[model samples]
Target: MEYTEGVVKDKETVIHVHPNDYEKAGNSYLMAIVAVIAGMPLPIINLIASGVYYLGNLKASYFVRWHCIQAILAQTIIIPFNSIAWGWTLSVMLNKTEPTLYYGIYLFAVILLNIIEFVAVINTASRVNKGENVRWIIIAPLTDKLCSKKNKSPYPLY
Candidate 1:
């Protein structure tokens, strides 16, 4: 294996293990657009649904109970709308008849949206993993010190 920039290439074919940054950035932008177009509706729906649930069912803490209810509401609303939009875009693209300008634009938008979504997910996942590792590193020692102070044990198991 040979390394070029941050990418590892196969010795025989020179195929890169990591994609180029520009490509990744382009994908990330697309993902952000998809998130905005497809995902923006959910938060509003969640707020409404959670508000209703919180008011109707007053047994649990509104803040804590609303989180789960909001997630469910968001999923229910987002999935069906997203699926219909995706299907409509696909059908227009796959149609055998002469494609209209608007159809072409719609197809392009859907493809671009998906690409953007892929990039965003990749970037977010990478950042989250990095952040989580850093957090754990910082937290572990603090947790140990707190536990040790409370229990009078120098070594914390966890």
Candidate 2:
């Protein structure tokens, strides 16, 4: 079977993915976005849905696996922030507590962050769909470590 490989040099390793793999990989991110939008009222639902979608794609090709893993990891990082925002909003609603400037600012910031993430996801997916590789400054190391080749140890190394 012939495999397509993306070329990356000079501190970047580009893994090539076929069109099918590219679509599959991009679908993972899209799934996360859908989960977020659909589960907006309940953050836990979003988390579970996104987590399932992300994990389900891990067994794909190197390119797809890396892209999906990165998306999952990025979602994991954002989950806590979302939880905090949701909790604050819920508390304010249940207690009838007046919302403060701080709360407003924080909510605004969270919304901005989410918007940025959504844009990034779309951009990355588009590039990936076009056979272009995308890199995340924050998640790059984790993706590299998780996707790195395992060392061959013939000396019974477990």
Candidate 3:
């Protein structure tokens, strides 16, 4: 009777242990897959959006230049960093590793970049609303040669 009881108790313990192990293994596998899928899209999306914005800005109408420039700048600096951070975090999580100090630095850099970008965007918008020139707000300098004034007749003699 004692031997049978001990054997039954040991079997029960083994059964309990096996289920816990299986649960942990299943969770780990799920987490790894989720991390990879989540991380992979970020950089690709950033690249595509930035490229499209940059190209669209190249031929933007005069009235839309300010908004286009703001979009371009946001895409250029903010999106890429954001994507990198996501990728880094996902990689660390998938590897079951703690985030390093560099992750904090990357986060800080993203914040600072965003703040600067916000200031730039606000300044550009204010200037545009006030009917001031906005060429300087953009990354590239606008030349007088490219101005509409030079391309049109000063008087409506025609």
Model 2 vs. true fold: TM: 0.81
Judge candidate 3 at residue 130 and give its lDDT: 44
RMSD, every candidate, angstroms: 18.0, 5.3, 29.5
Best by lDDT: 2
Per-residue lDDT of candidate 1, residues 98-118 (tens digit): 567876676676557645544
lDDT of 2 at 124: 86
Leading candidate by TM-score: 2
Ranking by TM-score: 2, 3, 1
- Across 13-45, the per-residue lDDT of candidate 3 in tens digits comes to 311112222222222113222333465445455
**TM match of model 3 to true structure:** 0.45
What C-alpha lDDT do the candidate models reach, one value each? Answer: 0.37, 0.72, 0.43
Tens-digit lDDT track of model 2 for 33-116: 788678777656655765686567545566667777777777878878888999999999998777999999999998898889
Worst 10 residues of 3 by lDDT: 1-10
Stretches of model 3 off by over 4 angstroms after superposition:
1-60, 66-70, 93-96, 136-138, 142-158
What lDDT score is found at residue 108 in candidate 1? 75
Quote the positional error of residue 47 for candidate 2 in Å.
3.6
Q: What residue runs in model 2 are displaced by over 4 Å at the alpha carbon?
A: 4-16, 148-158
